[model samples]
Target: MRKHWTIVTGLLVIGSVWLTACSDGKSGQSSVDSDKPAEQAKSYANEPAELVIYGAPGDPPEVWNERFGDQLQKKFPNYKFTYIQRSGTNTIENMIASGAQVDLIYDSVGNAVNSVVATGSQLDLSELVKKHNVDMSRFEPATVEAVKQFGGLYGFPVHSGGLVLYYNKAIFDKFGVGYPKDGMTWDEAIELGNKLTRNDNGTQYIGLGQSYIHVLSMNAYSLPFVDKATEKAAINSDKYKKIVDTLIMAPAKAIGYKEQIATLKRLFNNNDFMKERNIAMYVMNFGLQGQKDFESLDWDMAALPVFKDNPGMGTQPYPNFLFISNASKYKDQAMEVLKYVTSDETQLALSKKGYIPVLKNESIKNAFAQDSNVKNKNVVKAVFTNKFASPIARTKYDGKLNSPLQTNLIKAILGEIDLNTALRQTEEEVNKAIEAEKKK
Candidate 1:
């Protein structure tokens, strides 16, 4: 019989399960340190002759391999890689229990904690990093710091999802509104949104739109949802107040007291800007360019809006990390693999395909969207027009904090509650959620 090691904290599992994975659905796998069959025993990471790698969602071998598998095979044909995907009961936990390889984990920060940290299979790569002379300075500083945000240096960030401002050219031309430039502040953006939000011939055109659910998470200010040090809610501060207030006003100049919440919901959707043909401007993830809905619009993109204090800043970096598990005995080989994963060659190929590279090199950043379906070179350049904000270290309660803040913000917008009351109520609710998680 095999013995299983349960995760230390249910809080990490709870938080991770609530948050979505980087590409696929959430996976709650366990770890193994038990005896197994002879053939299965041969699959450990120390047995470098055979190895396993978990890939991102897509195709049979995780779509990540579709592009780079051949390259890896050409260099090392004997390296057997089991690209473990989320298939029913065929989870990493089961594999480890069955004596299969446990090595590199390619996932986002949120899932990284849930998948490995929660299961206690994590292996810190700090010593290996120094041994291999990996240049931490080459990547964006935020991405490097973010890998260590949870505690130890678990992995390197290889890719990110970026934010950019999208606008409908035809809508601007019709409204006689000047097209938005790259560096408008949130206030200036609202003024532009105000011009476009009108019921022209009953069409009820919205001047501006945004991904409201994303605004708080990808905050340009790098504000945190909860403070890890105190394990308490950290959202009652002035910065949070400013963020909520800005979100309330960004879509409409003055939303009618009765229609405020419904109006925000309608405008916050991506479809409202793309398929519905109502929104003139929108703030969204840059990857939406590949959506089929984009083919119908006369649209282009601009840099994400900046705060007046910070002249030209982009949204915080939301990167996917390449984690190495402690279960692996071959740290040196794993370090080399991580090196190849972040090399300029791998970064360039993925960048052309619109996977935002983590490297800080201007040439690599500039190459973004060059090979995508996007035909406009100028539009591609706008993605890097501003400097990216550092990532906010995430906490287990980020998802819990999102709702209370949005609810109170809407109440404040409708005059049902003032800013002080809204934030006060939000903090109370956040603390309650935290207490409940602790009890579990």
Candidate 2:
């Protein structure tokens, strides 16, 4: 009778290696003969197998296949590669609770850690990466660092989407201001915003509806939410304070107090750049590929504005990682699949189709969005000219820290409270939450 892979309990890491073992009912050890070394085993690839790859919180099954499914299927024809879609009912927690085996989980680095890694079932791939001779240097350094910020090689990126300023040419033309240029500083961007913001014929054009949250979250300062050693809220420092004052509050305040709240709310809405066309300059990431109306508009791209103090730097990298799970018996097979996903051939193909390649290849950047829906604009200049700001440590408390920081920051932005009060309240709330998180 044929044997199947079963989930292993107590897969512990001893010393420098992951000392894990799973069985196929017939054997007390792994599927391979116990007499042979585990590394010497074929990783169960000799037989017909199924690998369950889970994607979550966003993206449908079809989208998954288009980006990864088809390519992975072609690369590994021996195994049946499955994509498990996370739905309202079928969550990561529920999937784990129900005793389903997920071989790999891929999503935005932030959400993936919060949903999947927080389950304590995530595999640190340091040993496996070394054993396979996977080159970590191929990826943008900061993205690799973001994964290690949790203190292990938890995962590696498949693709990236850093900040870029998308400006409406019509808005700039009407105002007769020269469009914002590449390498513009935060101070320069504010001055540009001041010129374009107006109530021309009662249209209420606000110049810098630049996705305020993205600007804050992906700030060039590389500020953390909580200090790892102190476990205290890290947002109260001068670095973070300057970020809020310069990026978050500046744009809304420029539009004037009467429309500040409404203008601030519009920051995340892309329609301000496309449909209403009232926003002059909106900074967004690669998610812009999904915008259908952008191609029809008179638009262009510029580098994300940098702070004068940190000139030639852009927002931190936001790369989506393909993570291997600890419970998987098909660890070798999963790593093989990841290798294919990040390979030069694969990354270049995806980059041409407007999915930003995670590999640090200039050729890939130059060819980016060549066949994409928004191919006409200068995408390389928009994204590739500046080095990504070094990213901060993404603690386990990152998801929890968002509420206090944003809520207090919003209140402060609207002048309901001062910036000092906002910072203090956030620190207290986050510190209290960190203590609570420790108990769990």
Predicted model with the maximum TM-score? 2
The residue-level lDDT of candidate 1 at 229 comes to 81
The deviation in Å at residue 322 for candidate 2 is 0.7
- Global lDDT of each model? 0.66, 0.71
Error of 1 at 328 (Å): 1.9
All candidates: TM-score: 0.81, 0.85
Q: Where is model 1 more than 4 Å wrong at Cα? A: 1-48, 55-62, 87-101, 255-260, 263-267, 375-379
- Put down candidate 2 lDDT per residue, 261-334, tens digits, no spaces: 54554234576677878878888774774777865788888888888888888989988887788888877667
Best by lDDT: 2
- RMSD per candidate (Å) reads 9.7, 7.8
* Tens digits of per-residue lDDT for model 1, 128-161: 6554555577888878877787787888887876
- The window of 10 residues in a row where model 2 has the poorest summed lDDT is 21-30
Q: What's the C-alpha lDDT at position 305 in model 2?
A: 86
